[model samples]
Target: MPQINEKTWIIIAVVIALIGSLIYNIISAKKLKKKRQQFTRSIQSSYTHMKTIEDTNKKIYEISNEINELIREQKDTKGYIEKKKKEIEQIRQMIVTNDTILDCTISDKRDLATEKQIAFTYNIPTGLPEIQMEDVDKIRLFANLLDNAIEAAESVPAQDINGKNKRYIHISILNRGSNFFVTIENSKRTEISVTENQFHTTKLDAENHGRGVRIIRQIVAKYDGTVEFTDKGDTFEVAVML
Candidate 1:
């Protein structure tokens, strides 16, 4: 056999190096893509988790307000006091219970709203079923709805009744064939001032605050439901279909 020439050997070495470099590039590309995907998923999960926490804190704050009010109403009868005491405990149980929060839970939240002088009404069907969500999620969901409704309604004053402003919130649940609906409407004293129909939070620490409607959207996504908002000049309405 003829001895291989140095030129041929160099060419062979160069070709082998080129092949190895190509393989390395392909492997590195795959690793980089996998890492990118993992990072993206991590970011999404963290965002979802942070949003959930923020909303829960809001619910807790709401419950705290109710508790504070009960503690302040010291001029009521003993029977009334006992009744509120049980109500306080019941609301507290909702905070930690694993069972889903239902219309009755909504009624409790409405009571809190009424304490704020915001008239709230909810009409749930006699045969209505529990929403398909966890207890915490259900609370968060209604908390966001009722909370936002209260804020908007508080901003707007109802018919200057006796020279005083009134606030009102109306909520109703409906069963539409294969889906459930929650319709909430609040009185707005002024025209809707949102640009491009965007919802903005007035939270001072906005970086840590979660968007209420966005959080609702996330929860609604799990139910494969849809959320719709209609700002009707003097009324802001939200319809959640699940």
Candidate 2:
């Protein structure tokens, strides 16, 4: 106790250094494990946030599509209203005059066979040549064409069982060389039957309906026009040349 040997002191110092090293290693290992756990938590949090953002973006995209569809529907409604108004005004003018009047307003409701709306589009060429035809005749022809187109389109199924797109109708009129050409196209579920004999309709109920095509043919014939009917796949096309 009075005088410690140098070798013993040295051995004691080595033992102390070994103990300190072990303690330091243990502390460092604990700290390293804690850091690893923190890093893992941070990574999981980031992944969660990313997934949340992705879901949010998908919802936003769906909402945007819905908004766009709403806007399109509104526009179509507006257009239909305006067209009806114009037709009503024309009918009123005809009543005021002493000319023979024809009720040319076609119904816009959905047909019984199909749940889709009866859509119609009309086109009148600009810069029409001066002709001898009366305004009433023009209106009658256009009205009949549109009516027939609507009927044809309504005959087809709007949405299939798989929820596909609805049927539609398209009408175009072009005046060339003192003649007017009208084309009407409609989406069809099955192939349309075209005949040169008596006119036939695919409409199931024969009591109240099924005469639209015959009436259109008569109207076209009254104007000394030629009417041609054709079928292509699931589409029916009617052309009138006057």
Please, what is the whole-model Cα lDDT of each candidate in the order they appear? Answer: 0.68, 0.57
Candidate 2 residues 1-242, lDDT tens each? Answer: 58899998999999999999999999999998976775565456445545644665675576567558768777555564565566445433221111112111222112221234644444433343433444444444555556555566667766779987557776565677768776778776564455663335556643223465566667768878888878665777888888
Please list all clashing residue pairs in model 1, or write none if there are none.
none
Q: What is the TM-score of each candidate against the true structure?
A: 0.52, 0.44
Clashes of each: 0, 0
Model 2, residue 78: C-alpha shift (Å): 23
Say which candidate scores most in lDDT. Answer: 1
Candidate 1: regions farther than 4 A off: 1-100, 158-165, 191-197, 200-210
* lDDT digits (tens) for residues 142-193 of candidate 1: 7788877877776765548586656788888888787888899988655443
